[model samples]
Target: MFMSKNEPVSSPEALLQQIDTDRPLPPLEQWNPDFCGDIPMRITRDGRWFYQGGEIRRPAMVKMFSRILWKEGDRYFLKTPVEKVGIEVEDVPFQVISVERTGASPECLSFTTSTGEQVVAGKVHPIRVELDPLTGEPSPYLLIRYGMEGRLQRNVFYQLAEWAESHRINGRQVWTVSSEGVQFNLGEG
Candidate 1:
């Protein structure tokens, strides 16, 4: 689907439906557009979208831009079928704000991102945690299609922690969570 940059964007539902979950995401991993410098855009650690030093304030606009969000290396960008622009990210590019345990025996866990994309915890959307070298704090993330990940909010991480159980991995102990018959290590306990 060729989308004009200025054409009024559609709802997030329409955007998501266009990208089939069973199929690969819109080839962001393959795109290598030239950086268009900073665009006065930033996604705060907590998931708020800001533009030109002001909060976007409109969820519709946030949802619109999110559909085109692409991460190349350490930086983030908004890409259309043609144009690409670089932007700043104070922390993670996206944030997982909510989680819902569903499916048979509640083995499937679904996470809702700040962009409104819902990803199920499984092979395609595995959950991971990284410890900060400086603070030694745990930072949890959920895969959000392609190579993109949504950093889980503090409370959301706490929610997943409630579902986690300690297990022995190798000769050490680890915090793990299970979904869809698969177990994911949250971190070392």
Candidate 2:
């Protein structure tokens, strides 16, 4: 059943702790909560959260909500043990806000999302680039967790390009990077 506006929601602070990124996430996959209708919350392409036409300026609140975020098919929702609330997503739910190269023996690219989720690019968390057919513009993404992906910011993409090495794969020239002994194609050359 869809919950109406008059149906009161619990306080955000009561839902979870704030600013503790290391906290473990809820087992949303195992939850079979009932739909509580859509909320005014929307996650922007650049990683901004908005509610009721106003931006949710608190990073902690955003992070807290992100912990319970669940994606099913093409829709996204904030799921709890008891209920689920639909939300809007402009692009992806997250943005790869920053990235850094780490490890000396087998150097890896470590990515940090706006919500403070850190993911290392490798076989488990692969990096993929998609090109728009009409514009031919590149959009790079990193698989975050549980089928969630974070779009790489323009600057992060440029950084990867700078470190990318040229290689020939399947008879085509391409830019690649190696992490955990796995070669990932950055783009066609």
Candidate 3:
């Protein structure tokens, strides 16, 4: 079930790490081919809930059920399950502000998830697109951005192609919408 604004979460890092360790990493081949390809999408724990950052006093976790893939040369799209039985899914609209693809991957920046949650209050924000440096000029790399409540301070970006390569998650090929924008990559740490 989805978490209530009154619930409590222990540690974000520990929670994420635990979920990562406990869940069976899906094979890359299993990932939807349409969702696959070289692109980035936001990643969240399958069952955990998310809360607002600073203002949220209670425990909130966003159980990410599916993802939206924003690829270049196409329109924006979402890849969510048919339905979430017990969870209450909120819809937060978002716009693609800036996107960048670099270092064999891509990242995007937009309204912070928490910010959207606070303003929009219980809605899924849109995924923003950034450039991909590895693929020559900057281009949409199929990335989605989401606000992480509870413990995360800043927004997080997820890349589908990178996620597939790392987790080996696989799926069938699907078509998506695209928009025009510049590309970029995250610099070295």
* lDDT of the candidates, in the order given: 0.75, 0.85, 0.27
Per-model TM against the reference: 0.77, 0.90, 0.19
- By TM-score, the better pick of 2 and 3 is 2
**What value of lDDT does candidate 2 attain over all alpha carbons?**
0.85
Model 3 reaches what TM-score against the true structure? 0.19
Show how many residue pairs clash in every candidate, following the order shown.
Answer: 0, 0, 58
Alpha-carbon deviation at 187 in model 3, angstroms: 30
Identify the superior model by lDDT, candidate 1 or candidate 3: 1
Q: TM-score: which candidate is best?
A: 2
lDDT per residue for candidate 3 within 1-189, as digits (tens), equals 222234433344343343332243223223333332111223232212333322222222222122222222223333322211121222222322222332322232232232122211112423233335586322222222333222122222333223212111144332222112322222211
Question: For model 1, which pairs clash?
Answer: none
Clashing residue pairs in candidate 2 are: none
What does the lDDT come to for candidate 1? 0.75
Residue 73 Cα positional deviation in candidate 3, in Å, after optimal superposition: 21
In model 2, the Cα lDDT at residue 176 comes to 87
